[model samples]
Target: MGDNEAPARRVVADYARPNAANARSSITRPAIGVNRLQIPPQIITMVTNTIQFHGLPSEDPNVHLSRFSAICDTFQEQGVTEDACKLRLFPFSLADRAHAWLESLPAGSITTWAGMKEKFLDKYFPPSKIARLRSMIQEFRQKPHVGGDAEAEPGDNEAASRDPGSADTVTDSVHDQRGGTTSGEPVAILGA
Candidate 1:
């Protein structure tokens, strides 16, 4: 045969020839049991670094809520389940009065993070109070002081000129209850 034509048959078979030793056995293997395919329970590693917070009287609900959110975030980043999140929260909850309040609830009341968060907000930051505070802050305006001897006092200007770097020499525009502009430091409104 020509070099291009080659041989019609290969010198050796491409596949192995079957033999008694390699032949399929007549004995049938037993069927696999369902248990073999069943998945095993996953083992979850508990969180090691627990979050710390001061007890209630000192720590407000807002502060606890923020810390709680941070703890939840940490659990989520670790691929922990909601149940694990609740479990992780247990230690910190017992640490603070605010947290303890939630912990004191009936068993199963806060099985999930959502439920826990709801209870926490309801107890600490009531909707009515939050709304009222928000509205009051939004409506709040500084009142400007009307003309007075205090305004005419050149002593303030003289002091400012005397010591430009002095903090006491600073003059800030303040609004009074009358909504008039006055030259003075702004007064801080407590618990507003």
Candidate 2:
């Protein structure tokens, strides 16, 4: 009785990576799961179509930041919610890119959040609500000032909550600093 044989067990659920035994199963993983939808129906949240538009190819090898900026601009142009941009920045590189782009915007470009938001919503959004999208985006991008790719991730939910779909991302998809869904695979949604 000193050493008794025990049956080995393995958890078959939540199999993200491929399993040799289940080679025929093709249930792909989702970026965001339904269980994570913290907000209920009727709760106001920004649309997270951050990738709504794409920019032209960059000839420079260091265009990672620039590309990310281009993606952010896409959200602005397509009337997409800034929440998507904020969520996309959670992985750091995009946020850094966003920060760079925002910083580069002409100084005083957003002199008054209230006023600029009025204009932003006037054209992009309706009902005269969500008057802080522009500033919120600016703040998200401005967080990683000068800390582009050299810092450890603080793992803040700021990006996740704003753009839940973007948290835990693996793509530098915009610039691909990390990669894209090919990278780590995010787990939030609606720009969280």
Candidate 3:
């Protein structure tokens, strides 16, 4: 072959080779009992438009999966299972880092929605983050409001701030309906 023809033949040979990327799939699409499982294009568009998980720290994987499952539930075909629809459409909702993470999973590893959800949550909202949130919840305590409405609960500053005499500053005992006083100390009823 001539020099120019050799380069053209090489290009054709490269094109003829099987694409390794297409040989393996991260998600195993379930066999829908029906012969034809037709998913409307509009439905796919709705999912892509409604929610996308980009793997951001602020993005909650639980919320993302919840929304995704809700959307998947809407797609009810006669013979196709909800899981089948989710398997096909879930990929359309992932973008940026989230899409990359899904693509990186081993071929045929995620066979079900539950498996995908577990992997996604474990990767994003790990045990360390869950423990920290639980700890914060256990430690949370409402601080005393220290001022405002006489009828307000000791620590309910949100309710007291709405009153006209919200500037009032006094002891928690004075705010109580039961005529209890603390150390008999004089309190400012309005304007600190």
Candidate 4:
């Protein structure tokens, strides 16, 4: 009855725990399931990389990727130019892990974007970046003793500067669907 005191709260009687009732719990993703939509002709081939995305909140990887592509298209249409749209571009697993890690941290502690990145790195990133670091390393496992191996020529840089469409480096994975495996992922990753 004092000003400093608060009334006692009680749990609702209807609430029931599944474990107590001998019931099972499961997770689901409705967005990834069968939906009426055309498969995208364009696919992003991440060579020598692994992207961990949050697949639980999302169901279809293709659908999520399409949304990311749409955001890119919107930015291009608005005449705003930049590199890859890092905002929407996240690895499925990394996103989920980052989300969980952030939730674990005390509120307001994640004050800056860099803080989030640091925590994300501390939680998920390996000695190197990306989900498939081992595969990326293996991609370069062969002969490469030269200093200028990774560097490109001036003309090659100009060619690389062109808009992303059917680049030779990534073309094989994107268009290989004709001979590519349609059984698993729509976009088959290379070196990952």
Tell me the whole-model lDDT of each prediction, alpha carbons only.
0.48, 0.36, 0.80, 0.40
lDDT per residue for candidate 3 within 98-189, as digits (tens), equals 99999999999999988888899999999999999999999999875455455655555533345555534334525553366456665544
Number of clashing pairs, model 1? Answer: 8
For model 3, the superposed segments whose C-alpha errors exceed 4 Å read 1-23, 144-192
Would you give me the overall lDDT of model 1? 0.48
Candidate 2 lDDT at 142 equals: 41
Question: Considering TM-score, which of the candidate structures 1 and 4 is the better prediction for this target?
Answer: 1
Q: How many residue pairs clash in each candidate?
A: 8, 14, 0, 11
Q: For residues 76-109, what per-residue lDDT tens digits would candidate 1 score against the true structure?
A: 4233354444544444444446445644666545
Write down the TM-score for model 3. Answer: 0.67
Model 1 regions more than 4 Å off: 1-63, 75-79, 93-96, 145-192
Candidate 2 lDDT over residue span 84-158, tens digit each:
333334223322333344344453344332333343334334443344656666677545523234343555323
Compute each candidate's TM-score over C-alphas.
0.42, 0.16, 0.67, 0.26
User: What would the TM-score be for candidate 2 when compared with the true structure?
Assistant: 0.16
Stretch of 10 with least lDDT, candidate 1: 38-47
In TM-score terms, candidate 4 sits at: 0.26
